[model samples]
Target: MISEREILVLIPAFNEEGRVGEVIRGVRKFLGQSAILVIDDGSSDRTAHVSREEGAIVVSHPFNLGVGTALQTGYKYAVQEGFKYVIQLDADGQHPPEFLPAFTSKLKETEADLIVGSRFLTGSEERMSAIRRTGNKLFARILSFLINEKLTDPTSGYRALKSTVLQFCVQDQYAFDYPDADFLLTIHRSGFRIEEIPFRVDPRLGGTSQHSGLAPLFYSIKMMISLFVIMLRKKSADSN
Candidate 1:
């Protein structure tokens, strides 16, 4: 219902040619003129071509950069292009675009710096195991303890942010892992307020779910350690 805000949606896709087009189409159908950008992280597949053909502005990387790199590209584009708001979504068709209206509506009203779309905060349409849900909750608790932020879903990719907030700070420009709560700590250290919006999740259509096993292990160790180091540095900065 809230149409007063202008926001751009950035989708970081890597070899998601089969699924990116549908995502763009769904986003366009739901959010006309809202601007969508698909960052192709050096995908060998037809990701860039399909995205451009589907009316999404495409930015391609020379090779397979991680999700963090793609996101940074999207952030830079959003900042340079004078966009007021930016929502980051996946290109594999897991994010339910139907719920975007609620996220945007809250962003307009709350003036929130970062708005994260949460699955545990609401119902999920996709089938998930209890172990995964428990892992998410326990991780969320740990994140709340470390960062002391009221975050429910630290790993949820469906997230929104004001352009000003995005401009405030970022870390590990290219080598950053999955981001999640650890990356958000960068914003928290900068003293920005983050909001969480409840949303549903759906099964992906093509490609594969990227989060699992060693990738997640890498994400947890590197991203957390990096954030911890940042927290200490931030504390030092505050003292001085």
Candidate 2:
């Protein structure tokens, strides 16, 4: 199994002050504080302060740059800090830190470049709204076909990845906004091995979700366009 020291836990937050702390503590409890980095994407609230108080390494953005950019910042930090692997979870408490160990174990077992946390694989979609569930299925089918591999939940934010994938993500061409199905497809098309595992998600501890409201509809359209663009790109290289 991979040691905790080799792993960096990344949480991207925007106005998630009240809930990010709990997620950080849960990770520290399980991982012994090897490295817990929170990227505060220009949150007007006290996200950075609370994260610091909870003993996390905070990297704040000047303005809200969306979760994808925030995630890239964390990836760059992990690379510079010499972490071998990165485990990212949401700051809103939806992603449980209890499943983190499974990711490391899967890494050791399969050595996959990316390990995606999936709700459909374990039938943990009960927490997702009807619209989200439908969108997930539709995108999953499209991505699976595009990659010629099965994917249950391509939109899941919870995931673990190796340094190789991290290096890929830091490139200028990477998505800076919503990194969902298109992001996964980009990784897969770039020849990174992708795997999925079952993980349970809980409701947010506080605040509304970024995915709520008309955001999902907008995301769906944006993803559709992004996926098409990805398909038009070059094919995969040799798999690692």
Candidate 3:
């Protein structure tokens, strides 16, 4: 079993100055000042400074890269720093830190390479637009069929994974735009083990989602294409 020191809490933030701090504090409250890494994705605001002030290790990008890139950065850092496990959640405050223990416990018990927190599995619904809700269900169904597993929320950002999984994710082939369903599907197809646990998602505390506006429409199309392309490609030889 992995010790607390082997785990890292990674939060990717872009323009989430006020909310990110709260997220950091919440993690510290449970984990007791564990190694919390915040990837400040080129925010024009003081996101980096605030994260540092909250006692999190901050890695700042010079310009705004998408959330996928930010997560890749965090994974890269975790691998380089020799973290045995990584737990990532949104900085928008939607993913509650209270669920961190549940993720850790499930990871320890199942020894799964990846543990995804599902908002739908517990019958708890997060307040989302009708279009987003429909899109999530559609993607979930498709991914479940593809993976041959009963997955409820494939687009969930709250997740925990072993560092060995990051070795593949840090590669250039990993998606950089919106990792969502495509990311999870690629990992699952690559022979990595993935499991999901139910968790409650709170409303966003501040700032707009990168997926706001016409992005969702583009995301849906792009994700479908990406998912199929992943299916066509051969599984990675480097997979565990």
Q: Which candidate number maximizes lDDT?
A: 2
* Per-residue lDDT of model 2, residues 1-240, tens digit only: 678899999999999988998999999877884799999999999999999999999999999998999999999999899998999999999999999888888989995799999999878898899999999999999999998999999989999999899888877878648778999998988889999999998888989877777888888889999999888988766533
Report the lDDT tens digits of candidate 1 across residue range 1-240: 344236889999998999999999989877876988999999998999999999888989998879977888888888788787888888888897887778777887895688888887776723555656766776688778877777888878899888656675333432455767676666666666778888888788866767666765665667557766766764422310
The 10-residue segment with the lowest total lDDT in model 2: 231-240
lDDT of 3 by residue, 6-73 (tens): 88999999999989999999999877745999999999999999999988999999999988899999
Q: Which regions in candidate 3 have their CA more than 4 angstroms from the true location?
A: none
Worst 10 residues of 3 by lDDT: 121-130
Please estimate how well model 3 matches the true structure, expressed as its whole-model Cα lDDT: 0.88
Q: Mark the regions of model 2 whose C-alpha exceeds 4 Å error after superposition.
A: 236-240
Clash-forming residue pairs, model 3: none
Stretches of candidate 1 above 4 Å error?
1-5, 129-131, 169-175, 236-240
**Cα deviation of 127, candidate 3, in Å:** 1.4
- Per-model tally of clashing residue pairs: 0, 0, 0
